[model samples]
Target: MLARDESDLKRTPLHALHLARGGKMVPFAGYEMPVQYPAGVLKEHLHTRSHAGLFDVSHMGQIALRPKSGKVSDAALALERLVPQDILGVAPGRQRYAQFTNADGGILDDLMVANFGDHLFLVVNAACKAEDEAHLRKHLSDACDIDSLADRALIALQGPKAESALAKICADAPSMKFMDAGPRRVAGFDCFVSRSGYTGEDGFEISVPAEHAEALVTQLLDNPDVLPIGLGARDSLRLEAGLCLYGHDIDTTTTPVEAALEWSVQKSRRKGGARTGGFPGAEKILDQFERGAPRRRVGLKAQGRAPVREGAALFADADTGEAIGKVTSGGFGPSLNAPVAMGYLPTALSGIGTTVFAEVRGQRLPLAVAATPFVPNTYKR
Candidate 1:
């Protein structure tokens, strides 16, 4: 999500609740969102890692695509034209991570696609929603019914205890596993609950009606294990999980391969697979798959306590070093109690344990290319 002017910012259905909880509101994705609550970012980050954290992600965009032929596979096939994922293979009540790529092989936006038997549901970034909707309509309208779910609000219940907390209010929560998604009555409200989240933990992302968003969130928070988390903690959590933030770690400038997201592009979409080279930039992406991208995204661990922030230039040496790349996302990993970051580095220098330099505050600080999930992922399979 992109930041906007405060005066022009919008509010989510739970805006009043945020303010009531002493949230520190800031402009984000054209919305006045809470960056941190009274408990603060550090506590929120650690709280989420240990227990459950509820996030008000209502600013995101929810869209539905129903096939004109009344077959879900038809819609999936249509969607494959826009992304390089094997959407047709996604089973009912299952979800997959995908990206909308431009004609030049750059990532336009990363999104979640859930198969709902009859229709497909999509959750896209708030800042790119309008353009994403337009892109979908322009390409798939002839084969599917494109509907923007403007009345829905999104919330993510993530962490180690998320399932237990949610199961109390939604009995079906226990039956769902990772990547399982479908319509479920949550907190007695009709909603779509996906057993998936950005945080690398057992969690759920629920899509509730705008009118009942506050009630649902309030009910979840009533559980002592669940705390309200803001954007600050959310970023730190995803960063530690080795996940990408749309505009920061990925954007129109980076392809899935360059971003180290090649795992998301299934073999079915690659060369010699059942469906090969139909999506945009297939030539470039597939070629990268066959060979490799020049530069690759890698995890960076700072040698000291100071956090390395985004946009910090990377150097090949500590002194008189040539600029090799730049840090895309960097921050302190509360779980690891150390600074962690991610950036692009030439493939030759992207190996784990490779030492690099990050120019920060007129100093070239040494950083090691470490294995990701700066902390181990607790995702329940």
Candidate 2:
């Protein structure tokens, strides 16, 4: 979600492999990453939509929180103190999306929390890794032991055929449903595979030792259905999927309620539940839940050829306009062959059929508030 200079960026284990494939590299989240390959973002995006696409997402932070007493509920309870989610309800081998919130109900970072039976597994934004780890250590030290898996590299295989391609190399991959994750051996290499990905498509994210990352990816690439995808396509894919990128869509200044992620906060943690209001910012969040957020993040489908970029202000019309909100992320949906964007709007203007306008190049483009996942999710559930 962040771009930077390439001079001193950290490299993932598969960075050289990306270079070999003619990747156009750039700096992102403190790492030297491939923004696109020779196939280009458009083709790469379309290819992933058709076949299988492999991506190196090792820049994400992977950590395991183990309780000293080996109590899963203790770790879940400890986690509950920091965020408003039903962590204690996580079943073994299942994962849920969670956001670390602040005292004022602002989001610190959104993450995936997996219940691994004996411990809790977390994957957070790479740019916020150090701070996230520190937050974990500072708060959960008495309840759990947090260990950052710095030696591991994460990669994802996504698309309609991702499962079949993965099954060719790993027997267990085909059996996973959405949100299922556990340790597995693929082509004799030890790894933890999850039936989840950032793309709207059904896929898997594999975490393996840094030393074995290349070998695993190499074998997967050898499959006829799999092609290497880059960050550019990855971003567009998630945007089309209606998934929120940490820094761009949801940030420390935004709360879950304002972000329209109430579905993520389980009902057990909401008001009237037996164990409610224990987490940070619970009062503010629950209050917002009842009274409704002042603003909401809504999907906009621009009805023309021009693509709207992020940060563009929204207006009622070209003349005598009032600033309503700003786009957080926008781009041409390769699959839809049209411009799509997401932004905040007042509650009164957030209905799916509502009409709005985005200011682009001194012109006003009409946009309709369509239901998101601009592309439907093909998740295997």
Clashing pairs in 1: none
Give the top-scoring candidate (TM-score).
Answer: 1
* C-alpha positional error of residue 98 in candidate 2 after TM-score superposition, expressed in Å: 0.5
Off by over 4 Å in 2: 1-5
Residue 55 lDDT, candidate 2, scale 0-100: 96
Q: Candidate 1 at 205: error in angstroms?
A: 0.4
Write one digit per residue (lDDT tens) for candidate 1, span 196-218: 99878889999999999999999
TM-score of each: 0.98, 0.98
Poorest 10 consecutive residues by lDDT, candidate 2? 1-10
Candidate 2 structure lDDT: 0.92
lDDT of each: 0.94, 0.92
